[model samples]
Target: MLTILVTGATGNVGQEVIRLLLNQNCQVRAAVRNPDTATEILSVHPTAGFSDHSIDRVPFNFTNPATFATAFQGVDKLFLVRPPNLANVRKQIAPALEAAKRAGVKQVVFLSILGADRNPILPHSKIESYINRLGIPATFLRASFFMQNLNTTHKEEIKTRGELVLPAGHGRTSFIDVRDIAAVAVRTLMEDGHSHKAYTLTGGEALTYYEVADIFTAVLGKPIHYTNLSVWNFIKQMRDRGLPMDFITVMVGIYTTARLGLASHVTPDVEQLLARPPLTVRQYVEDYRQFWL
Candidate 1:
């Protein structure tokens, strides 16, 4: 029974990872900020389909060095994800990696963004460098933009304002589903021949925000529009919504990168990993149609 410690266990990706791992009867320790709340949430998660006893919950905080040792104990592999709110990798993630190293953790499968190595401006690029500096047996899952963002970050506006507003001007993105990314993470954690490898995960196709809006309209049977705003207006809207400046900056940067056509690259990695076609944007929109409605 190889034990894998999962950071950010309650997040979108982590929860899916834990669910998929448990379906395979793999031992998973969910490292969360609050074990009790996490346990409750997992038990009730619509897709989790597991009880509290199905997975282990341990207190782990990226900012707290003390919890890392305890969470990493007896863990053979680690599933690492940087919390979206935290930008300072040196102060937040470095300590945890040190603790994992000290705990003698064997391998790390990190969730990194696409083009992290080339984009030094992104924090994930710095974290990737740090992982390399540690010389740990690591695999980087460089995933494209998540399709779940439709259900999360942009959900409210879609539901209330009937529009998708962003700075991505006619830019297409390879929107991969988080579930597919989780499946790849589980395979890398459990299988062999993946160490020291970097896998770029993306959907089968690239679609622009306008195309996504059309999908939403088709699926929800209503008129949904894509409001392409200027980068300045996007920043102002996010700030007015009380989002942190760092998060807003990162969001805008990624959108700008997409607008420049850097994010439109589609890959076969997801299909190659799963031996099946990746989910399409239309399918994703149809699956979550109720949310948009």
Candidate 2:
């Protein structure tokens, strides 16, 4: 069995990847900061029904270099993701990638964002460049906007404020479920022929926030709307809510990119990878309807 080391193992996408890997009967070593917390969380996860011996936990912190080698030891492949708050790529990620290369890991599946190579300002773009510089055999999964945001960052607004607010004015995004991205990542890690290739993972359709709100309303049996706020105002609101400046800036840049209609392109890569159509926004909303209610 190939041993895969998964970073950010407790995160949404990481958890989904772990679930799928376990279902495939692959040996998974989850690199998390807190094994006890991760064990508690995974024990209750809906997809976590396998034996404890199938999934193991190891300590790995991107900001801490001391934990890298131990986590990378005996790992054949790696599933890497940059934590959203860690912007200093050179300081945090570069060393870890270097360590992975040194630890004899053969292949890496990096969770990157769509258009990462084109957007120099984004940390993911820089990380991708660094990965290439190291000459590690890797595949990049440039995933689009995640539909799980409705339950995460935007859930409060959808439930309390009765609206979805962002700076993506009149622009559509090919929002994909993180689970779909996870599935593609699993394939890339386990299957051959994907080395050094970048896959743009997206949902089946491109929909504006307005259209998304319509789906939310229909699914929840209540009225919900999309509010387009100016970028500055959005930043101010996030700042007021105590979000860090770095995170706020990153989010503004993403929404600004969408506002320019750059993130609206729909791709068939997810379907191609999974051999089935990607999940639609309506299906996602219906699946998580209780969150909005």
Candidate 3:
């Protein structure tokens, strides 16, 4: 069995990856900060039905170098997620990639953003460069905006105010589901012939926030509006929500990308890799309707 070490194991994508890997009967090592807590979370995961003994949870933290070797041990491949809070790629992520190299991790699937390769200003680009510099065999999954962000980040606003707030004015984004991203990641990790390549993953359709709000309305039977704020106002709103400056900065960059009409490209990589069409926003809203209700 191939042993795959999954960082960010408790995250949305990580949990789904674990679920799929377990179904494939692959040995999964989940690197988490708290094994016991991870055990609790994974135990109740609806799709991840593995018993506690099936997974090996190793304590790992990007900010703490001491935990890297133990997590990488005996792992043939790696699925890497860059925590949104860790903005400094050089300081927070480089050492762990170096340690993975030392531990002989043969392949890596890195979760990156859609424009990271072209936008050197983003931290994901810097991390990609470092992975190349380390000479680690890797596949970059440059995923587009996740549909789950509606429930995770903007849920409060939508549920409370019945509106989507962002600085993406009249810009369409080809939003994808995290589940699809996870599926693609698992395939790259398990199969051969997917090394040193970058795939831009996105949903099949590009839709503006106005269209997204219509989908929500159709699903939930409630009025949801897209409040297009100015960039400064959006920053103020995020600051008022008590988000850290680093996270706010990343969001600003992402929205700015959208506003410039750069994130609107739809791609067929997800369907090609998974042999199924990517999930649509209407489907996402219908499935997650309770979040807005």
| The best candidate in terms of lDDT | 3
Q: Candidate 2, residues 1-293: lDDT per residue as tens digits?
A: 89999998888899899989986757899999999888887776644554566689998899889899899999999999999989899998999999999999999899999999788878999999999999998899999999998898899999998989899998889999988999999999989999999999989988888999998988888999999999999999999889999888888887887888988988989998899999999988888777777
lDDT digits (tens) for residues 199-220 of candidate 3: 9999999999999998888888
lDDT of each: 0.89, 0.89, 0.91
Instruction: Provide the TM-score for each candidate, comma-separated.
Output: 0.97, 0.97, 0.97
- In model 1, which residue pairs have backbone atoms overlapping below 3 Å? none
Task: After superposing candidate 1 on the true structure, give the runs of residues whose Cα lies further than 4 Å from its correct spot.
Answer: none
**Candidate 1, 45-163: lDDT as tens digits:** 64646776778899999998778778988889999999988889999899899889888889999999999979887889898999999988999999999998889888899998999
| Model 2 regions more than 4 Å off | 46-53
User: How close to the true structure is residue 162 of candidate 1, measured as C-alpha lDDT?
Assistant: 94
lDDT of model 1 at position 74: 88
Q: What TM-score, to 2 decimals, does candidate 3 have?
A: 0.97
Residue 189 displacement (Å), model 2 = 0.8
RMSD of 2: 1.3
